[model samples]
Target: MPYARLLPPILLVFSNVFMTFAWYGHLKYRDTALPKVILASWGIAFFEYLLMVPANRLGSTVYSAPQLKGMQEVITLLVFAGFSAWYLGQPLKWNHWAGFALIVAAAWLIFLE
Candidate 1:
């Protein structure tokens, strides 16, 4: 458990990847049936939960719940940024970066002692 502090964030990053896909990966498949997409998203979310639950459980040991949430939020944005540009073919605009920067700054505040 030497990597306790580091591990949770890494796990969260992976978890968020799955979550982002589960939530948004269907955008490109607009013609797909709603029920089919829902089922697929659920399948993807199962994996997300697998990683997310452990990430939270382990993160609680080294970080407060707020801090862990902060970490996950930031990681979600970062992962989504990449997935947006590369997978969804939608790059973030400058305004989006500005908004995310502010959010990240707010997350930093939670980490302050």
Candidate 2:
């Protein structure tokens, strides 16, 4: 795809990445007494929705709702993969890739002829 063609998907991908972190990263702070991470995550989530809503609206023009949502779920996994690897420094195991492959296969099925 051309650079311009990639812009919306890229934005959606980034938005989902931020969203995944905002939604799940707070789990790490569960042991803390204050547990302020939930509040912080909510703040971050606001921005995630800000980008995500527009991404869906714009992407809808080019992709049907099912396709857009499918893409969003895949993008969410992709973003979560990176977030898990980077922030948590977790290893990207082969089994994880295998699971993602299954998901990609599902996407193919969803968009199939």
What are the TM-scores, per candidate, against the unseen true structure? 0.99, 0.82
Model 2: worst 10 consecutive residues (lDDT sum):
1-10
Backbone collision count in every prediction? 0, 0
lDDT of 2 by residue, 1-113 (tens): 24434566887887887788788787667775555877788888998888888777777666777777778778888888888888887858999999998998887677765
- All models: lDDT? 0.96, 0.78
Worst 10 residues of 1 by lDDT: 68-77
lDDT of 2 at 17: 72
Error of 1 at 46 (Å): 0.2
Candidate 1 lDDT, 1-113, residue by residue in tens: 79999999989999999999999999999999999999999999999999999999998999999999999889999999999999999999999999999999989999999
Off by over 4 Å in 1: none
